[model samples]
Target chain A: NAGVTQTPKFRILKIGQSMTLQCTQDMNHNYMYWYRQDPGMGLKLIYYSVGAGITDKGEVPNGYNVSRSTTEDFPLRLELAAPSQTSVYFCASSWGMNTEAFFGQGTRLTVV
Target chain B: GIQVEQSPPDLILQEGANSTLRCNFSDSVNNLQWFHQNPWGQLINLFYIPSGTKQNGRLSATTVATERYSLLYISSSQTTDSGVYFCAVEMAGSGGSNYKLTFGKGTLLTVNP
Candidate 1:
């Protein structure tokens, strides 16, 4: 099963450009999350959704936005991408609270 | 907000050697997990031990919720085990049900032949 899938395994964005990192899960999980990992640092939460239409900001939410329109899709949007926004983005999903989370392969983004 | 810290920021071991990685949280948590990120940047879940201990083959994990700490043990390490190990936790009372995971910097492990 394709637990969690992220599109555009790698991308290069110009300054001020906007792009959406697509994420979809086939496990029918209720909770979805977006996180980014910088060089030599742990993954930091960007946004999370408990369910469809319910989204919340996480620890590092600036320059990023997320929308959960359905149970399987949670896409992250990066507006006005800047050099500081360059990082590896990961999408994760869990069955519910306190459950094991599954992560995607990750999208390596480079903002120039 | 909850704080998670992982010990031994870096470790190197010869094949067949064993090692233990520790994770400490600042407060109580409802969920605790360990993940290994391969060099290719893929995060693989190793365990979901919120409490007690669980063993899976050569890898095992123990979580002491009351003490706000967790330990991940790897036995007979291999070169493929070289990666960044991360500890993540979801605070118990952060948002009633909208729990978000907070991660520690991570422990980099390198296994040599």
Candidate 2:
């Protein structure tokens, strides 16, 4: 099973450019989350979805947007990429509250 | 907002040595987890111990909810165990609406041969 899949394992974007990080899970998890990890730092939550069509903001949500249109997909969007946004992004999914979460390989984004 | 803190920002160990990493949270939580991020940047879930202790092979974890702390123990460490260990928690929210997972800075471990 492809627990969680993230597209564009690596990407370099120019300043002001916008892009979407794609994430999909085949586990049919109800909770999905988007996080970014900076150098030598732990992952920070960007956005989360409790279920299809339900989304909420998380810590460090600035410059990022997320949508949960289906049970298997949660995509993160950067409206205006900035150098500060350059980091490794991770997508995770869990069956529900208090359950083990599965993470994607991660998307390394570089904003120049 | 909840705050999570991990001890021993960095650790160097020889193969076969054992080590323990600690995580402390500022508030009560409903979920607690440990993850190992390898050099490749893959975050692998090591344990989900909100309370009590659980062992998996050479790795084990204990969470003391009453004390708002958790411990991750690695036995007979190998070079392959080199990575960043992160502790994440979900604070208990009113009405069961908030489930945002917060992470600590993490403890970097390097096991040498």
Candidate 3:
């Protein structure tokens, strides 16, 4: 099984540029999350969706937005990317509450 | 919001040695999970122990909800086990389907062969 898949394993973005980090899962999980990991820091939640059309902000959601259009896809969008936005982005999904989460390989993003 | 802390921040152990990693959370939680992030940056789920204990091969985990702490034990460590171990938790009152996991800074483990 593919589990969770993230596109553009690596990317370089110019300041003020906008891009979308694509994430998909074949596990049919209902809960999806977007998190970013900075150097020497733990993963911080940026956004999460309980199900299709239901999205919520997480601990660090400033420069990003997420949309869950279907059960399998949860894409994160960054507008006006800044140097502070550079980090490794991870996408995760779970079947329900109190369940194990499966994470993608992650996208290493660099904002210049 | 809940805070999760893990220690020691770094550990080095020789192959065949055993080690224990600890995770402490500030508030009551409904669930706790342990993950191993390899050099390639893939978060591999190690355990989903909300309370009590569970084991898988050479790795085991225990979580005491009342005490708000969890422990991950690795037996007979190997070079392949070198990575960053993270502890994540979800607060108890996170009602509805929106479940968010708060993660600790992680404990970096280096198993020398």
- In angstroms, give how far residue A76 of model 1 lies from its true place: 0.8
TM-score of chain A of 3: 0.99
TM-score of each: 0.97, 0.96, 0.97
lDDT of 2 by residue, A28-105 (tens): 899999999999888888888999999988878999988999999999999989999999999999998777888999
Q: What TM-score does prediction 1 earn?
A: 0.97
Candidates' lDDT values, in order?
0.93, 0.92, 0.94
| Best of the candidates, lDDT | 3
lDDT of 2 by residue, B1-113 (tens): 78899999999999999999999999999899999999999999999888999999999999999999999999999999999999999887643335767899999999999
Q: What share of the true interface contacts does each candidate keep?
A: 0.83, 0.81, 0.81
lDDT of 1 by residue, A11-107 (tens): 9999999999999999999999999999999988899999999999888899998899899999999999999999999999999877889999999
Q: Lowest-lDDT window of 10 residues in candidate 2 chain B? A: B92-101
Model 2 Cα displacement at B7 (Å)? Answer: 0.8
lDDT of 3 by residue, B8-42 (tens): 99999999999999999999888899999998888
Per-residue lDDT tens digits for candidate 3, residues A1-112, read: 9999999999999999999999999999999999999998899989988899999888789999999999999999999999999999999999987788889999999999
Considering just the first chain, candidate 2 attains a TM-score of 0.99
Worst 10 residues of 1 chain A by lDDT: A93-102
User: What lDDT does model 1 reach?
Assistant: 0.93
